[model samples]
Target: MKDPNKAKTERMMVKRTLKNLELNRMAACYVETKEDALKLVRQIIPDGVKTASGGSQTLVQCGIIDFLKEHTKYFDRYDKTLSPEGRKQNEREAYFADFYLTSANALTEHGEIYQVDGASNRISALAYGPDKVIIVAGINKIVPNLRAAVERVKRHAAPANAIRLASGRFCENTGVCISPCFDENDLMCHADCGDDTICCNTLIMKKQRIKDRITVIIVGEELGY
Candidate 1:
């Protein structure tokens, strides 16, 4: 395997690049395991705060969901234990939460966060509503730049997510993003994927108009799609 130190150093460079763009930032942190990430997450999130989360394999992998549910007043719509109506109520409450936690589809070295959503609740919270947004990204999610960021989502993140969500798209079966050539203005596919598209909404977190609003955590371990 590649040296773990080298991997973390790369993520740090991306974190620094993000800070240079003047988005609120904390120094990139490297933890050895998922348990360590969970500890870090628990420490960062204050007790009794109203928190909510977007769907993230990373969150589950790092043991954040259980921790948040137990400690913080977290609105989790993904809980299978909740009734359908209850889940919808949770999702609606999440929009007004004090903190919103999520993982990035791709975080570019040039300081941009690229994400795709089916229903867009997550992206909407990231763009504007929440009092605080914490984006937890594993080193693997870092890309070279914006183009690579988009490519990362389409080629890797989206396909995995489609299968996980049981979206019944071509990519779910073929495990490919099925890119089609479109104009400069259009980044989404108009190809065979049609109505079953998972790339329904795209959000690019660029220069932050509000300082200290979004904080990104760069975890050393590989954690998500």
Candidate 2:
């Protein structure tokens, strides 16, 4: 069974995070399960709308990818039949999609979305492009502050994602960033992963000019790396 006290504490944290996210001019909500998350996503995105997503395990875990494929005009960049050029074309087209879906590397309780990327297409689209952006992340992705958010990505997200993508990056073999140690001065947290580093681009989303254009769904269950 789950610990009731821990669950209560998490609920409080999610509440605070949601408040801050709204204060930052972004929409935020919490769901108790992945099923609820999927349902909320469906409600936010109507059927047959043009949709695309960043490469996110969270979306897969929540069945959002399959839902998009079945219900929306989804641009599948991962389609096996697509040649390199075709995949590139699909990725470019995703910028103009009606809805863009992604998961954050880290979401701060102070209401910031932090993401690290390789090709940077994901961050680019999240920053601007899609008419609406939906971020589905688990409570495990939340942190106390920006500093902790950065640490979470370096210590956990980067290494795990490297293994997933089989990018042959240093973090994949090391199970952590090349330099995991960080002080206040090391907020940028640069790692020496060489030329093929997946952490090439980093994005920190704070206050948004476009209110509610980005909606964040924070699942109570741990869903992704």
Candidate 3:
């Protein structure tokens, strides 16, 4: 389908699904543009609240970290492994924090939120552990259906993210980059070593995962390159 048609259908489906979930949805300039997204984040994050992250580079590229530092002393737990102490911090600061920010690869027309993560903490918080979840996504991440959303994540977001995660690792240093291809020494783990490993952290979210705790923030510009 044409991009316009696909967008229209997605808007309709998103509307229906959000209504079913009883979530409050709104359209903002940041929903399409980087500058606007920053502005919106500023408006939403209030005084005296801590923030956590999932290591989304787009958020950093958009200067969100600087903005947060200027506004408040929020802790960014982006790339750090989640620990018992970190979970305590998340719970302790939960009341004061406005929302936890994360990124998603695709948003289905039916309002399904899709995220492919190399770790579980971000996905865990976005799913049900947090009071509010805000998802930042590029315009290209929007899709017509659940299946298309999954395909978009695997083909586009997953590969890019895999390479990004592997950039400084031994696998990237070797002959090939280990992304979805599952190289021998991918950061998650060596495929030959074990199957029940956290190396299988790239997660595909759907269905009940799109509950009331989440909000979708769509950006007009191309992000997460």
Candidate 4:
């Protein structure tokens, strides 16, 4: 094997290159570790912000849900877990939110944010709707550019995410193409059909008019696998 130190140095160079590209391209940026992400969330919550989030298992793993539940007076929890009154409270708050916590697929050092969604709500909220959008990501999710971001999702995130979203054999298989059972009703495939298709055509935040509305928090620790 090559020198372990050299291998580490090369990886650092790749991250630095991607970061530079994002900067030159004018994307919003912040760097943090898992602890930093938590710290930042604590600070932002005190200023009083309402947030809406998709079902991101990674955020759950990061203890984000726990943080929000304990710290914020108002939050947009998924309707499934809330009481009817809490559900109404969430919707009412989302209507006039000035800031939000969101997640992204990749943060190019050149300053662009990339994300993919099945329902488009995550991308939509991050791109145009929220007055201020904060994207929290782990270092592992960083990539050189849009192309690399897609590949990262395909080779790694898609397969794992599909399994997490579904169950059984589908989780064991690693294929980039959308499954034939693109919908659950199709008996030939699992419930995860059509998932890859959704991830393939991601929303590029650089193309949005509300690009300024987005902010990024890049954690130094490996996160969101």
Evaluated with TM-score, which candidate comes out highest?
Answer: 2
* Ten contiguous residues with the weakest lDDT in model 1: 21-30
**Clashes found in each candidate (C-alpha, N, C closer than 3 A):** 0, 0, 7, 12
1-225: candidate 2 lDDT, tens digit per residue? 679999889889999999999999999998989999999999989999999999999999999999999999999987999999998888999999999999999999999999988888899999988979999999999999887887898899989998998969888898988778556655543645678777888899999999999999999999898
Deviation in Å, model 1, residue 194 alpha carbon:
2.9
Error of 4 at 182 (Å): 20
- In order, candidate lDDTs are 0.78, 0.90, 0.58, 0.59
Model 4 lDDT, full chain set:
0.59
Q: How well does candidate 2 match the true structure in TM-score terms?
A: 0.96
Best by lDDT: 2
Clashing pairs in 1: none
- Rank by TM-score (best first): 2, 1, 4, 3
TM-score of each: 0.87, 0.96, 0.65, 0.70
Query: Tens digits of per-residue lDDT for model 4 on 1-225?
Result: 658897587467446744563544334444445766777766765634455665565566567767766655445556477998876566455535666676666666455666766645566556556576666777777776666766666556666676666643343365543443233343122345544444534677654454345556666566775
Model 4's C-alpha root-mean-square deviation from the true structure amounts to 6.0
Model 4 TM-score is 0.70
